[model samples]
Target: MSESAPTRPLLNLDALFDNPVFAGGFGLASLGAVLAFARRGAISTVGLIRRRMLVNVEISRQDPSYPWILAWLSQPREQTSFLARRLTRINKLSVTTTTSVTANGPTRASFFLQPGYGRHVIKYKHAYIVVSREKQATAKTNTGEPHETVELTTLYAHRHIFEDVFTEARALALQAHEGKTVVYSVRNFDWVPLGEPRRKRPLGSVILDEGVKERIVDDAKDFLARRQWYVDRGIPYRRGYLLYGPPGSGKSSFIQALAGELDFSVAMVNLSEIGVTDDKLAFLLTKLPERTILLLEDADSAFINRRKREADGYSGGTVTFSGLLNALDGLSAGEERIAFLTTNHIELLDPALIRPGRVDLMVHIGGATRYQAAQMWDRFYGDVDVDGAYRERFLKRLDELELFGEAKEGQPVTRTSTAAIQGLFLFNKNDMDGAISMAEGLIPPKLEAEQ
Candidate 1:
């Protein structure tokens, strides 16, 4: 035998190309493209830095515009986007009519769009939709209390895209309330936004001492206009006031009026209310919008004497003294905003709550001054100007009643509270003489009741 031909080991040619068919049909270039696409898909699904963010209705109330955003996003559209993709959740065996109220409008029967998934294109990128639902007992139903499940979604996207969408959504929300004022309060441990009152009292309507009014207005103007100044000085752009005085002294009224004048919103935080814990307070305060007036009514009673309150059968809630102080000095404590703590007993307040950095001004809205009484008269009587004789007569009546007697030269007049005078006017109904006669009975007792 010819020197036995050395048998060459059988070569496995398929090993050269991991996927022989792909290489054969598409060639190396096309195969490379296919592999690249698969790699990208895998990265996007697991390795790529796509991010997810949650905006829970319960928690996001901290951001005032969150509700508006949800409304905007859920608004029903008459027509779908040309580039949109629709998803059908389930096909019903028989078509049934239904009516549902949506932000855009009401939908009846066939007019309703099927619940489905959709995408919205924003400036930066596309936002995908994924909804979650949980059965919850809701008080906001017309039917005999029913257990219903509502759908809420947490948006997912690249970080930049989410930021861009949020920024735009917030801008739109602010614009919606541009020339209007909103009242915000903490409800169920969340900030609830309420529209401006049907009848708003103008800032000019508040009959404050002339000097006090001027100072407040000037300070507000300076604070709101000094964003750059605060930034330059490394100062937290915030201001606080302690509106301490007797009840019905116009503390609350002044705040409401100030909101109107400044075109700002009012956020009322009542610490004595149920569920007002330290965390909730901090969240509410930190999330306040720019140029808002945060009113903490009855600040003195807000924290002190909590155990005594519990013992007295008051079951609302109690905030620890340290917690209140921490919240005031917390993350959201300092911003480009103004806060007012209205109290009947400033003496009961802790020193920390009224420390220098926390309270910038202390305004004592005492009983109606002679001038203030006159202004109240002009307002109720619809006068464009003060009547010297009417004012003098009113002042005389006040003196006879032992209300704040006429002021000494260059001194502020002391008198019964504005509320007392207001009650007299309200009871008499535009009868100046009648109100003057009833004013004495309306004088609050020398020792006023606790708020």
Candidate 2:
């Protein structure tokens, strides 16, 4: 009797949505509750499956493995791959920066393709694998480039799949760079690859004065081999070579060959580059890539206006001289490094910059010598001057015209560069006589005037 009295206003469908026990807008409370429960159950079931039956991995753009994976996937159809060909179809594709010299002429730079930024699938060894690539701007590179992450998922039993995939990818990447030199340059405080790997320049190709190449190579090898010695002595494991002379004297070439000989990469840093400051320089020096030789080209010219830039209030991040010095030898100086500085005007460089700890070895990569000319001739003709006959005749004519530097008892000779000599040889590659006839161009202006 009491319950019947309380139900005087009978509940209807409209009453159900008036902020009832489970309030819902528009839809009735019962329908909304049912939908919510189903949605939650679906989410829970999916999560449980992911946790119990699936395995996953995440690779950030910062990781070296990231490129390995991308490179593996982006390989063209003509190339051989372990899993790339197994992918039956990938509708979503992205164009990448990598390129190849295809027979196609002057087309757009869409030579390379990879799975675009979305969900992708691959069939590897008869197992299904899912790839999800996502980009977020919450993090940025030095140049404000978008940061990305790739997530890979597969069955729980396929955990070893990642190791195998990455292993093969890394090997492929290394094989591409094998027997080639990787040149790096700084961009926005980070070292980036400068260009396609250069065909390795053989050490024998760079013909220096006798004992010069050997001495430099031996020192670098010895220094690299004696890491424990430097550590024990509490000395920073750093070595610097200052190669100073006129332009085209093989200063840069020798460094490249040296790097190739030592199986090392080269990082070229222009200290006076815009936006390069004391802090940035220090940061770059500290974070140099491993097994890389730091090459500071035109060191003298780069810093000549360091003070002038500051005084003029040039807002660009110009490097300070003090910053350069500190980066070379201060607390921020990197260990296990080989530094090469090439300058056409060594005399203009500050003495402080070439001090003991900073510039350990000062080598003059001067003009081509009689020894160099002869060796280069033999090499250019693809023959050995075993009898010294070709060298004698070639050098004899060079002396007659003062093409090679004049030999005097006490006077310093102004000689031509190996590059210049090689250029002349190439101009008359078929005719040694033609090369000799063109030898007058090789004479230094001072020698010509004095004669």
Which candidate comes out best when scored by TM-score? 2
Give TM-scores for every candidate, taking all chains together and pairing residue i with residue i: 0.62, 0.81
**TM-score of model number 1:** 0.62
Worst lDDT 10-window in candidate 1: 87-96
Error of model 1, residue 229, in angstroms: 2.3
Q: What is the C-alpha lDDT of each candidate?
A: 0.64, 0.80
Query: Which tens-of-lDDT digit does each residue in 316-372 have in candidate 2?
Result: 466666767777888888789999888888778998999988999998877788778
Who wins the lDDT comparison? Answer: 2
Off by over 4 Å in 1: 1-66, 69-179, 194-200, 302-317, 382-388, 406-415, 445-451
- Residues 1-451 of candidate 1 have per-residue lDDT tens digits of 5777788758655765667775686587788899999998988776343333533223132235444545444444443554443431222212224354555886534332222222232222354443332334454332233333323334543334445556776776767666667788765544556633324467777888667777887888888888899899988877888888777778888888788788887988776665676556776676675667888776776556345334654534655565566656567586677888888887888777888668888887777787788778877765622445655677788777666655565545565677777778788775767766666675556533421
Model 1 superposed RMSD (Cα): 10.7
